[model samples]
Target: MDDAIRKAEILIEALGYIHAFRHRQVVIKLGGSAMEEPAALRSTLQSILFLAAVGLRPVLVHGGGKPIDRAMTAANLPTKKVLGRRYTDEATLAIVAKVLREDINDSIVRQMRELGGRAVSLHTGSTQALFGERLKLKGPDGELVDLGNVGEVNKIDGDLISSFTDAGLIPVLPCLAYDAHGNWLNVNADTAAAAVAGFLKAAKLILLTDTPGILRDRQDPKTLISSLNEAESRKLIAEGIIDSGMIPKVEACFDCLRSGVEQTHVIDGRLRYSLLLEIFTKSGIGTEIRL
Candidate 1:
């Protein structure tokens, strides 16, 4: 295809998405191995800016567990991983807050500024206590453990996030949250994103993952499931077909849908312009979980 024709096609498609999503809120859960890659990082930023420029409100909830692990190792602190979930101890919790909230959140804001979007950081602890719950995930020593100070989000201050959206500013969120007593807690980024989306009554929730989408066969990338309703998703989970790293994400998607989010998408973050393709193209590149 000629360059000008391709550009025109992309422009038209982007305009279509903008028209369809204007005045709608979208919560994006950014994670997986893709974010670590420079190209993927650039793509994600570009996509966010594009969405914002087109009048779609986007709230970015980011994960920094891998960087936290690396920082912990460098600091000679012990790290734990069980069932693909990180077990956060007191030390780990401190590190997580620093990395996710300060470092990662600030970096995203800086990039957004460069992308011509006004962005700011939102920390759960600083704003208000939006999550509370204790869950245990196994540790590196292969023993049953308590993930101290960890949290599962049960609430979100929609007004606070919405205020930013109303101001034409994108809210960049960290996975860390706090309890009613102001106790800091670590939360799964995907879970955090879903809770926020539900609270804000967002029109869409987009989860960027390493996989292409939800696969009928985990071993086969081409066996992607294009769409699924909430009940059918639960059936798949009951059958134990959704396992491993995909489990939490899939569950989060379902949770968001049940909580009244219009649409939830799980897409491959590795592909450049994957976000645009999924949102603006006729043939999307990921699984779309809808209510």
Candidate 2:
């Protein structure tokens, strides 16, 4: 087959997905070591822009935990985490705010704009889209761990986000939220994206992370499970196969699915155009969880 003809074939194959998802919404949670590599990050963002350009509404929610850690290290502040969730005190919240709101959020918007895609920063702390109280986490001994200034999603401004997506603008939402008392709180990006997807009842919640989706065997890449339903996913969690940090991610998928999102996808961000492949092709590269 000629290369040009092969390219056309690819597009023809993608046409089915384009038709199905046209004018629908996909909430993307971008995270992990993928963000540290400039090439991979650029490619992922370009894929998102392509989705937006092709008439799909995309809401981007991101976390800059690595950069926040660097900032803390520079400031001589001790970094800590309980159960893989950051412990954000007042001082740490400031670093989180700066890294998420000022740095990462603006940079994503600028990148999207530079690529000819219009994106608006909708940081919950700034946009008043999310309001929450402090989050109390549990330890192994069943003790409540006080992670000050860290919040779980209590409320989200669905209408406000809708107005932006409805107007054809990509919203770049960060993990920083605000409490009722107007205090800033650091929300986990995975849960944040899940909450946003559930609020909009989005068609798909796509999470781009470091691993090869959900692997049946942690050591083998070939053990990647391409698809799983809600029950199977929950069973993985219950069996401790999806323990640790991955637990939150899979739980977020379950949350979105239960809230009417048709599917949740976990794709490897290291691969170029992975999002496009996962969404458009018949056999996707990652694990897709459906109802």
lDDT of each candidate versus the true structure: 0.83, 0.88
Which pairs clash in the backbone of model 1? none
Task: Choose the strongest candidate by TM-score.
Answer: 2
Model 2 residue runs over 4 Å out of place are 124-126
lDDT of 2 by residue, 148-267 (tens): 888988888888888888899999888877888888889999999999899888989999988989997888999999988878988988887777878888889888888888889999
TM-score of each: 0.90, 0.95
Instruction: List, in order, the clash count of every candidate structure.
Output: 0, 0
lDDT tens digits by residue: candidate 1, 1-291: 599999998788777777889978988888866578878988898988888877889989999877988889988998876456677778888888898877788888898798777988887545552666776655578676666777788777788888888888889888877777777888888898999998888889999998889887888998999888767778878787767777788888878888899889999998898888888887789999875
- What RMSD, rounded to one decimal, does every model reach? 3.2, 1.6
- State the TM-score for model 1: 0.90
